[model samples]
Target: MAERPVEADTEAAGIRDVQAQTRAWAALWRRSSPSSVVHVDATALSDGTGQDADDRRRSVRDALASAGAPARDRDLIDDILAEPTGAAGPCSRFLVVAEGEQLVNSVLSRPTVPGEIVAYTAVPDLLPLLLDRRGDALYLVVEAGREGGEIHVLRASQPSALRRTDVQGRADSLNKVQAGGWSHSRYQHHSEEIWKQNQTLLAAAVDGLVRELRPRFVVLAGDLRAVQLLSDEFSPGARAISSTVQTHVRAAGSSRGALDEHVAHTLGKLRKADESAAVDRLAAGDFENGAVGVGAVIHALQQGQVDTVLLDLEAIGPRTLFALAAGPWVASAPEEALGAPVLDSVPAAVALARAALVSDSRLMFVAPDRLPERAGVAAVLRWPTGPAVPGTPRWTQTP
Candidate 1:
């Protein structure tokens, strides 16, 4: 994505708008959830007579009574404790009351604010009274310090399942016919017993991974048998399964580098289908040159001749498209075209332009090297809304 620099005025306004929006959203969210209002009170008393501890405690109880909060017969004290307290912060003295497991009252008395109320609240009391209370699925972790505090709320994404394996094996071989002889290709493989164990293990791993990532699709990569095993080891609710029979040069536990490459390749292949189909319809003399310069794409978009925009995310493209709200034809420019900030890669910029064309605002990524020259980086012309079919290619050229 392009990093467009904002002017000072715009940045300040944006900050204010974001703050207002956050408050509005928070209010809406609170109203959407089950919650209640609560109040809490705390008090301390003077023990001026050098009286016994019992007398001093009685004075405190009398103070509480004076506050119109008399002890009830069925009241349950959740806890009560006193300790050395700070002069201007939270106190080490507090009490809690509960009716069975439900909190009813929570009060804290600060030593520095003796006889005067410090800080107290009753959510600690009324949470049990609230309906539809989410369990420990949610939690707030806070780090407190002098510069203020930071609070992070963590919540479970969703529920999912996976398989657990009970066994594994060394390796196996696959039959192959070489140029001059028949031979066996050695690779890591599992027998029926090992396969069963893997199925369980994979299922369990997939289940947990799905819950955490909440991905729309899951990709499986490895040798042919491993791909087959992945198909047999499906987890619930995953939308699609794609198997790639590629050698895994990276370690299984070190899945980051190799697995990422596999995902990129698989997704690229899936997107390439559209480009390939478009290329098939190309006739002789279609492209002025083998190259798909920026101007050609802009002309195509202007003529409403694009159904899909095939782009390579890793390459630098000379031209970029900008959509204006008023018309079918879009404005085109060179790199950082028309002063619009360019994305990190050419494919990314093209993807941004393609997103404008998708009904649901989704774009497919592709490798630039995969397209035929005649249709290279071209948008598939949409019927009736696009340019008419052109003549045959002027020259046969590779993408």
Candidate 2:
């Protein structure tokens, strides 16, 4: 049918957000029985019920049917169109991804993105949405003030704040501190104590969230003294990942747009930091718990040793890899993965991705040249795989 461009939205949305959805679906992609699942990625022509919409729906249906998409999942197109947002008339693009009988997820947005439909595939095709999302995974923003702080946990992919917990501190409505007054010293001390308690309370709340979510980014904003106190009171781990903003974010009449811009900037900084950390590790030859090339990476996946698979698709996507109908999921040669007349060969990127997903490992899509030359695929392991003791269970149990 109509092939959607995978890199269509890369410039608008960052890669971190794309990685979030990839992991999210990876968690769900492993549940199906072998050769039992197919993913449907489709975009509707219009959010309307007129003749044009009818023709578009028919076209999608015919294309999917021709491509052998399961009728059970193909019907989800109607269910997706039946959703309330379908009639909202404001969305510029509507996306639906389905697996077997499950309507996995749908996203409606107001960007001038192209409309296309992909019926189904053995491997969940994440490439199309990779560049098309403007959302981020998990992040935390603390808007601190005299009243305390609002700890907001956000995932832009979803509609609203996933969690917002407020830490109430003493609102010391300090009217005035007259130096000449008899009670001035006592009043000043009491006010200072209230401020201290407020910041301490805020820090405790933030620390709890940091430990709970281990968010991708954490930002603190408010009065300088209040921010400083909160930062100082925070747990070391929390303070290490958090950035501070001078804006009075929680203040009445504060601009949300401005705060969002600052948060986005922080996200960019964190991404760079992560890239640098990975670069330094790899550049220093830190392969003790990592794999550096395609063969080693495939072996790591076979052993169920990977935590995250780093891929330079530009270098590896078009290459070929063999897949098996049973355990030892993928290999460069059919014989290595238990060759059979029924064994299938698939794109290297797709085969490795499926292996990673089924093993509950993550995928990190890096810029093409970020990887060392010829090291198109690599992985950081969950644990060491070399020199295992006899009788040890080295592989993740495959379904």
Candidate 3:
């Protein structure tokens, strides 16, 4: 792996810490209560010099006004976007989620947008806040050596890294001198045995790590021979997702940037592979534990059968769907579908997202072209959807 360039300590560079910022948003997602949540996404129009600044924050606030957010809440948004320290300097966009007058959460970051403002009152438009954080998650990094190695465990919720564990096995005679005699041959045999023993133990440690954290992937790097030995020792399950990198974190000239980039690249490949596999399942007419189309997906959500929602939010757009105010949150009609009173019609994406949220299911965004079926809605379910029951539904990854 090649070394990636580090930032030159720009003012907003801290905000670009993807791991930390994403965890912050994920925590908010779990803590927020469903209500009249106001979500706003705005692109900066220009420098904060009078009118040009308002061009960026205007439309969203007007939309908020139309949606009837409390006056105080509306003013708060304007004040933030108006301040030079708020959304203009070093940051290119402003995103916030509020409830009534109190602000719930806000994320100011460096994502460029030409001209756009969005204000939606629903299950907190988290998709936008989290969109840039794809295929990034906790993973383990292993630096192998003939004698032993080091393992780095990254935390999903923390700032960046969590802990490092060193597994040092026997190093006796690791570098045997060729004395051209029986003793030399004996020392060589001892070193080989030590290396194998080291790998065997290291593989066990890795197995425990994979079982414990279920990391997105494991990165192995170090001396070629030792790395291959350790890789070959992994159990079938662990070997499936473990990979080798040319650059080792412990190498003399290695920088953290290189290892970090490799981990990220490995994560991205895992995501692309997963997306392809899921799409294949859908395309192959494998609906046993799958659901496609809006109606089926919704029914599965209401029934708590959905495990993951494969969505194409851009395709779903502004379409709305009927939902219930109480339990069994989604329904097509009041008396006919569910006994609960009618909940306000919600954007189709949010409805599915809300249902998935309540049921602890995941929402995964897929490419629009790949999801031309089912109104851009599909799922991999907890159990086989099996035979469609004539009514229910066609019935469904990541943190």
Candidate 4:
């Protein structure tokens, strides 16, 4: 089985695009003939040695064999194993199998912690990967000179250089003392004008990039003065997302590691803050437009009201929910899921994940300890639903 490279276009999928893909995957799971689904997670360092890449590939192969997939499906596994390791950016790779056919093979640019492989009866477990890669942050690192500095735009730690220009001014040179009066004053004025020009140019470039990227957060790094000037240039929305880092950009070879570390740390902090805010809101009875628990969340998802679904990573303790095949509803008990074919013994989280994806809602995972009131799963809705009428079930029950 030789795995082909993912299409270049899919490699650039943004948040909305990935949501669409998830929806499509859910639909496929619903409609496709029943077959074993294999998901493999292979990770290799961005700068790993060749041996590391080979080891990663072999590991994927070994995982597939351990899965005990049918002999017919060996080709699918082989194909996935053949995919070049370390070919992608500092991200992990995933492959999905169904009906003994390879369904999805792609590189995910998001960093997944503790990667693993699994075989599921229905849909692949994609919620965690999608949540991790949600590229909502844009990172910008610039240098501080009157000469233009390097500008790198990172959409979720994936870097792409946006621009680099020369700054126009030079700082006061103490090495050569010129005439004490008029000459010195003239030099100072000229330097100020150059600085002003550089600032304007830098701001314009940054403003354009922000508008185009439309990231949820902006991380700024490099020289302090340059960082400030660039921060001021951002649009109001970008400013709202902006955070500054103390890491100063130095020469290429020496500064890369430090700058990258700062950006990663800042992004991690922002992610945690966002997660905390969500959890706090839920804890405060902030379901003005949302719902908590598996039942309410599933009901909300069926109505396409959910905007984001939050799950506690540690709360996925047991399989307590079931899904109706080819239907838009889920039930707390297999008996409640009447008339439709039921996918029995499904993990509640997995079922909810599929529902969330089918509705094109975002999925977020939080540490189990941080979940509000120990609520294992919840959803932030797009709009408020009317109060549940007593004794009236959301789904029709067979008498």
Clash number by candidate, in order: 21, 0, 4, 7
Clashes of 4: 7
lDDT of 4 by residue, 1-399 (tens): 011343455335532334455666667656534443433455442233477766665555565567665655655656565555544355555666665787666566654543455554454566545555653454555455454454544456333443333434344442233668888887766765666566667666656656765555555666576667666666787677667767665545545566667667777787888887766655443355567777667777767788888987566567567766745656676666656677655667777776676667777777776654566788877765545467763222111
In candidate 3, stretches whose alpha carbon ends up further than 4 angstroms from where it belongs are 1-122, 129-137, 155-159, 170-186, 255-262, 283-291, 303-307, 322-324, 331-346, 372-374, 380-399
| Candidate 4 structure lDDT | 0.59
Candidate 3 accuracy as TM-score = 0.64
- Residue range 1-399, candidate 1, lDDT tens digits: 112344554334322322243343223222211122122222222123244533545544455445444254112221231222222434323333322232222223223221223112211112111111111122112211111122222222111111111223222322232434222222222144454454445545455545643443454444445445545655545325433434442234534465446544554554456446545443223533222434554555555555545444445344434432233323443332434332222232432343324221112234556555423354444533233346743433322
Which residues of candidate 1, in runs, are more than 4 Å off? 1-305, 311-325, 329-377, 384-399
Candidate 2, residues 1-399, lDDT tens digits: the string is 011233424312322445555666655444333221222323345455567666766666677777676676557765555445432434433343454455344554434332244545444444434434422457888887766777777765545555667778777644448776668878877887788888898888788777877787788887677788788898989988888877886667877777778877776665666666665544443355567677878888888788877777777746778755555667888668754332457677767776776677766666677776556787878765555356753332221
TM-score of each model, in listed order: 0.28, 0.72, 0.64, 0.72
Poorest lDDT segment (10 consecutive residues) of candidate 4: 1-10
Error of 1 at 271 (Å): 5.5
Clashes of 1: 21
Residue 154: error of model 1 in Å?
A: 19
How does residue 386 of candidate 2 score in lDDT? Answer: 56
Which candidate has the top score in lDDT?
3
Measured by TM-score, the strongest candidate is: 4
Q: What are the root-mean-square deviations of the candidates from the true structure over C-alphas?
A: 23.8, 9.3, 8.1, 6.8
